[model samples]
Target chain A: MDATFRAMLEHGYNDLSIADIADEFEMSKSSLYYHYDSKDDLLVSFLSFASDRFEEDVLTAPTGDPMTDLEHVVEKLLPLELDEERRAIQTVMSELRSQAVTNAAFREQFTDIDDLLVAHLRVVVERGIEDGSFREVDSTRVAEHVVATLNGARVARATTNRTGAPAAVRVSLASYLDTVLRGRR
Target chain B: MDATFRAMLEHGYNDLSIADIADEFEMSKSSLYYHYDSKDDLLVSFLSFASDRFEEDVLTAPTGDPMTDLEHVVEKLLPLELDEERRAIQTVMSELRSQAVTNAAFREQFTDIDDLLVAHLRVVVERGIEDGSFREVDSTRVAEHVVATLNGARVARATTNRTGAPAAVRVSLASYLDTVLRGRR
Candidate 1:
């Protein structure tokens, strides 16, 4: 699964053939097929896998302070690494997004990630309101704002940085948190 | 040029072929060569052309209230089918950003657009302070935040809308402007 996921990251799952994967892993197509049903299956599996991990991290992870936890979540979720792992995840995201345009299955598979993130943000906003960390704004809408800004920054960082410096991602998240949580009074 | 730009948007510039563009346009390779020195020329021209028009409209053409000018500029930049040409221009912006990463030249071109937008935003923040439209903050960085939100909202609307409704973009922009500029003092 790691090999398959990494392959998808470097070259999109849509762009790669089973032969390509086999060549990378030094295995035959029959062997590869034995493990996975099809290309889409592999992608769906990857999405499910990542989504589970992300949900656990965002929702279940123990972090104190709503603002700190929110900032930490964005920092972790950002694909800010030059290694194959980060690239593979980014390629998967980009691929899933393109396929989601016309295909319902792909859209359904990836929608969970968006939902989980939004739900997590909403919790943070609610807590912020209680703790007086945020003003009286619509929590859901603010959550959407949070998701939009982070997603935008993620996509921007992916394109802008070739070596994938964590600094850019960190600065962006800090600024985002500062602005969104601005004027709590 | 249209074919190259379209190809870039659909499949990314690196993924598309000059032959695909040449055949689609029904033009000889020689003629294509005459018009453009290289594929770089084709892609750069598209970015340059779009950015040039965007600069003139958003930056050069001014309503004179730097604070309100930006709000108006965001309006002029993001419009509904209430008009045609404006919609087309915004469509171009939302579409190209997806492919901007694949081409280095195009990426650099986009950075210029981002920089110019940020620079103009800084001017707005500074005037906003004087005009009492905004409280004091890091004007330069705050400007980057504004552009990031606007650009992010544009992409989010492109991806999330089922019927391609333009209303989502407008409401989000209004909300963001309200958040950023509210005196709250």
Candidate 2:
């Protein structure tokens, strides 16, 4: 999985083949084929690993408040702390998003990941609603917006005109919470 | 421009090539070259045309109640009745957005189109603020969100994913505006 991720990140997902992955670890193509039938299997494996990492981060985050919890989700999405491996995960995830949109086979898994993220978001919002820390807002809608904002930030960071990275999303997220939550941190 | 737009919509920007556009219109390569220098130029022309269509809809829209007027702007983003051509334009737009993140050349032209879209949103938000139709919000930030959501919706529509279409965005837009406005629309 580590080797699969490294190659995908450095060269985009579409650009790699099974031989390339085997060659990276100095393994025969036949040897690599024993582990995974196809490139799609490799992609699915990488997504599973990545998804586990994201879930772990969400589960363990120290969110002081609902807003901070929301911020924590944003933090994970941004890929803020990075090495080549992290970059590859993010890049590969991006390609997966595009692929998911087009492939029904992948949609279920893509949605599963999206559901987890949204559920994580809903947890914070629901807690805020219960604690009177957040305004009376549709938690799902707000959660979707928050998710979209983070996704949107990925696109924003990609643009050459942008000065910063995903940190730009933090500013947008702050304003979004302020408007919807109305000053309850 | 039309041929390239159609090609990009059906096939993603990365999937199509300079020769594809030339073959579509039955024009010799050199003859097509007479009108435009490169593929990027052709892509830019399509963007400029889309920009014009957007401006025509928003700028010429009725300026009655700001909310009502803004609804018109929102409608422009939503494809009320999508013809084959309109869907093609939308698909191409999505491809542009996906690539703009990584390609400097695409980024430059995309930035111009983004500015125009943001300007339109800023005007509506400014009008809302002035008329007390919306709470005082950060106009630039809100404008950016509007653009982000618009782009996001375009992706959803192009994508085969069951969710994240322009229609979903329209539904979300209403709630999103309500969430942020903090006042009567």
Candidate 3:
């Protein structure tokens, strides 16, 4: 899985090959094929592995404060500055996401990740509302906004030259929370 | 350009070949090459064309009301039910956007589009603030959130099974405007 992830980062999903991975990892293609039938299968496994990592890294480390916990989630979701490997992985993920437009398996796995993020946001909003830390608002709607804005920030980071896009998102999200939870100015 | 757009929808940028596009369009590859040097050039031209269409279709039609004008921009930005052609164009755009991670040319073009969208949002926010319809806030920051959320919504639509992702974004954007513009709940 590590080999596949590393390989996919260098060679995008469309160009990723089992032989290349095998060669890079010093394994025979047949040996590699024994575990995964094709590149797509390897990518699927990679996606699953990524989801697990996200769960372990972000979902598990929850502070009691709903607002702070939500911030943690955002921080984990969008790294301050993606390193080389992180950027490569992100590029591959973007390719897989574009593929999801036609590929069902990719779509399902990506959807699972999306659902997980949105669900986490929803929980945080609901908790805040229940504890009176947040004003009464539609939890689901706010959750959707938060998730979408984060996703969009990722896109903006990848596509634009803007270095402060993530910080901007954080600022906007804080304002959003203030509007919803802290009431009017 | 129409031929290129249609072909790109079917075959993403990675797999797209000039021969395929030429064959599909009944144009000789040499003839196509005479105008555009590479697939990237063709794709770049297509991006410019798409930008013009967006300007013509959405930005040109502005209602007097800032709120309604903003909604028009949203409507034009995120088509509710993308037909086959629209979906194809969107998929192609997605692929090109991913390409921006590596290709400087694609990155510049994508950035221009992003700037255009953000500028539109900024204008609406400014107009609202000027007219006393919206509360005084950082127009630029709010515009960034609006653009990012919409981009995120597009990602969600592509990756998830959520059929109402566009509507969800619309609702979220409306809520954002309300929170910033409409005062307390």
lDDT of 2: 0.67
TM-score of chain B of each: 0.71, 0.77, 0.90
Query: lDDT of all predictions, in order shown?
Result: 0.62, 0.67, 0.79
Local error of candidate 3 at residue B10 (angstroms) = 2.7
Off by over 4 Å in 1: A12-15, A25-28, A34-41, A78-88, A91-110, A130-135, A161-185, B3-16, B23-29, B35-41, B76-96, B130-133, B161-182
Lowest summed lDDT window (length 10), candidate 2 chain A:
A160-169
Q: Write the per-residue lDDT of candidate 3 for residues B1-185, one digit (tens) a residue.
A: 87887678777676788766776676566778899888888888888888788777767656768888878877766878889766766777777787777778888888888888888888888988898888888888888888899899998887678776678778878878776766735
**Residue A15 lDDT, candidate 3, scale 0-100:** 76
lDDT of 1 by residue, A1-185 (tens): 56666676566544676555665675466777897777776667767787897787656664658887777777666644546666656656765654554445666655667767777877887888888877665666666655666666665654443232234435644754565566532
For model 1 chain A, the run of ten residues with the poorest summed lDDT: A160-169
True contacts kept of 1: 0.17
Output the number of the lDDT-best candidate. Answer: 3
Candidate 2 residue-wise lDDT, B82-151, digit = tens: 6876665565676565556456777776677667777777788888898888889877777777666665
TM-score of chain B of 1: 0.71
True contacts kept of 2: 0.25
Better of 1 and 3 by lDDT: 3
Per-residue CA lDDT of candidate 1, range B1-185, in tens?
56665555555443556666665665567888688776667767878887887788778655556656877766764455436544444545544555554556766777778777778877877887887767676676556555655655555544544222234435554655565566332
Clashing pairs in 2: A9-A88, B156-B164
Q: Give every collision pair in model 1.
A: A9-A88
